[model samples]
Target: MTMNKIYSWQHKLWNKLTHHADSGANALLLKGRAGIGKLDFARHFAKFRLCETPSSTSEACGTCLSCGWFEKGGHPDFYHVSPETSANFSGEAAVAVDRDESAGRIKSKKKTSQQISIVQIRALSDFVYMTGHQRGRRIILICPAEAMNAAAANALLKKLEEPPAHVLFILVAHRPQQLPATIRSRCQLINMPMPDVVQATRWLKQQGVNEPEACLAAASFAPLLALTFNDQRYAAQHDAFIEQISASRKINPIELAEKMQQSDLPIVVSWMQKWCYDLLCFCLTGKVRYHLSRMTTIRVLASSIENKALAAFLRTLLVSQQLARHPLNPRLFLEEIFIKYATLLDSNGVKRSS
Candidate 1:
């Protein structure tokens, strides 16, 4: 609940939610794009519902015992379930923040796993049947609900099938399609509101972000993502990647792949996918969605790569993204993709000087 500050655009939804503070809905699923504040809204709503001395509008008073415990990250009646890799989880497994030196000490001991394991779901079953320490509503918040694997989702489904009195389940899903149909059907769905371009821009400026428009485009209009987009190093690396890939005739596939070996594979692949998407878009209609700032370069590159070859490379990128999550040799993986990309423009293996 500590990081549940709502954005300006969510005012309407917030007002609507206040009306249903005491509703009998056992489960509420908030689904939307990543960085649109669905999880934060859930946390805020949960805190408001559990406050012993809530205001007339049902907002947390912040001075009550419940508010204090929740802020300190030890509210007995409150439970947060997410992927092990998610930093929102509490206790020794909490994700470390860079602001504190000691935070890394514990986090370095173990790499956080990505899936919300079946063990976590099973544990929730026991907690659901148990009494709330404060005789209040027990709130269980599952963030990025799609992180649950088949076994974990099945275990969670059992709890949803048998509702416990005085208990509430709040599931926040960024990609609801990834969730099982049965699990999604059991919850009352709330689609998180998407901010208009003007509102998102204003919010980004308020967060002190430079080049707000460009950042928003990069994040696909996710305002929260635009706010946190301050990685200068990654921007430089991406620019270099674009340059290399655009001038495929002169670039050395092996050398470029080796340079990117130490970089984040998933992000690199994501950027490549976006780049390909823009190329395809340009090939079809001379329009670019993601790399607006590089329109001229994209236009030039789009004309060079075969439309059919570009389509096939997009599929390769999708496969690479899935494989990037698992253990694999970075150099070899990157090399293979780069080699395949090189073949698209130069099947003769001829290296032209820039």
Candidate 2:
């Protein structure tokens, strides 16, 4: 359940967390931008806490009962929560009613549109307060913890303030700032940054990604996005997005956003991130080797911008990405970005025919 290959820094942190030598925080909050091996790290931590014979100097033995259940993903004492709006699945997963000693598993591909509800939090609280099912402590992992609605947050806050003994909570979040102040104050924050391209490249290759460079090009070193980028399901759609941006060069920003909403937004944002990274790489390296998803497009893109301009474009891309998440109209957000990108390229004396 741990990263098959752990990096040096990750290994150091893993050691402290496992051995509890870094003992200031009972609850560890692993927060980071998307795709920095946080999930993998969390998995490793959970496995160690649930280890039947947690040793001082070695990783968990796969032969143990707890490790076996972890591999099977059937351990009742371990709980992992994720966002209700998770793209990996169609619905939300959470604890069962009353958090009573009930056995519920993380359900992906669920179509229900429920957020982490108050009931789920109550169940979690009760479960943590109850006795452990095994010899060690019970572990609760609430990921993308910001996705919890108001009621759920309140319920969770109470538990965080007075968590039961031998119950460990690991909260994973892409944006910790979005969490309640109480929640943030109650736990220890661990920053997980995005991996460098070299680290990313190595990890991708280890994942058996044949075209790891291409995946990197397509995802801007966001490992989970790169993982999803291995296929071409959204390739055509990205092309369509480029076409939309190209055609919106002179259009009003708001109008442009509406027109740009015809394609899948998440995938487009991912590409935009990759392109920004590629433009930066090109500006520095004078070569574009990693952006294989649209190497030709990036090559053309690189020739048109200086490093400053590329940085600005990346900023706009970040704006677009954040705006894509707000309750704002998606179309307007998309159009604004497309227009801005087109304007940037055009001002740089590079024009793509609409």
Candidate 3:
């Protein structure tokens, strides 16, 4: 299988990183917001560096022996480490990791952790010290570096401290601030920039997404995430969701919760947060952000909403977002959220606490 190509916007950054591959930096941290393709860029760069004979553009020759192993995710010199919940971890890689676990390693019967554990990091550290299966550069890619717990981060820190020769560490992180100062200071930071609206929309359209502008807006103008929303049919549902919430007085919490049960709770909560944000924007500046096409609806809703109540609801959604990954009855969670939203339009102007 061929690796997914990096987005067009990442070309310059890719070239710069590839040029620095020979600069002898052992650790590189790519930090940015979601959907900017940092991991994809890192993957392509790693392939290029590992390729016995790469193309003129410093891209991997897909037919090379090294490229074939990388594509199959069986490259002996490449380690792709991520949390189980991360989208970046392929099913094949998951199986391979399980198969390669040592007999002395502690095993857990419970679900694979969503976090990158100390065990995984320790194993990776050991792997890097062992003889390579091939005589070329070795690379370890750890995505969402924030997922590492205190122990795991400390374990990784050791590797960063005593740097290995001919080995490169690519750490892709969505939230760099979550990483410890010690861990962060050891690696070179690369800030991935968000693509402009025109570029984002054009790329989104090329992927055959409908209402690309609206989808991009809903995703905070992140093209890759916009494509995901479109693929999952969330973009189409967003308009109807906004319409439902705009009519806050008639909102049915149970019905709305049931309708959105299929969607991820965090995503649903995020959409609610964005809607409330737009309401506040309209209330303050008579303008909108995410829901640009719903200016009239937003303005009317903002007018009817009690400012205090809306503010409280917005704070409630923030808390909800934090708990989205935890165990919860999705329907009950959504119902409670929608119920609070309903009260925002109440004539009594009552503020509720979570």
Q: Please, what is the TM-score per model?
A: 0.82, 0.69, 0.78
Roughly what TM-score does model 2 have, to 2 decimal places? 0.69
Pairs of residues clashing in candidate 3 = none
Q: Of models 1 and 2, which has the larger lDDT?
A: 1
Ranking by lDDT: 1, 3, 2
lDDT string for model 1 (1-354, tens) is: 136467777888888888876667899999887667676677778778888888886578998998888777778888888665432433433322211111112112234454688888888866787888767479898865776878989998989999888999998876687789999899999989989999989878877778888888776687765544445754665677888888857878899888877665655676788888998999999888878889988876666677888899999888887665333577899899888888876753332323
Candidate 2 lDDT over 1-354, as tens digits, reads 134445544776776666763374667889876555676677677777777886658577767888887767667777766544232210123322111001111121224433566766776755676677786478888766765777888888888788777777888776687788889899888876667778788887877777877777655566655655564544445555554443423545565566555444544565566656766887687666544555566666667666687688888776565434332555666766666676676777643332
Angstrom error of the Cα, residue 346, model 1: value is 4.0
Relative to the true structure, how large is the alpha-carbon lDDT of every model? 0.73, 0.62, 0.73
Query: So what's the TM-score on candidate 1?
Result: 0.82
lDDT: which candidate is best?
1
The CA-based lDDT of model 1 is what? 0.73
lDDT of 2: 0.62
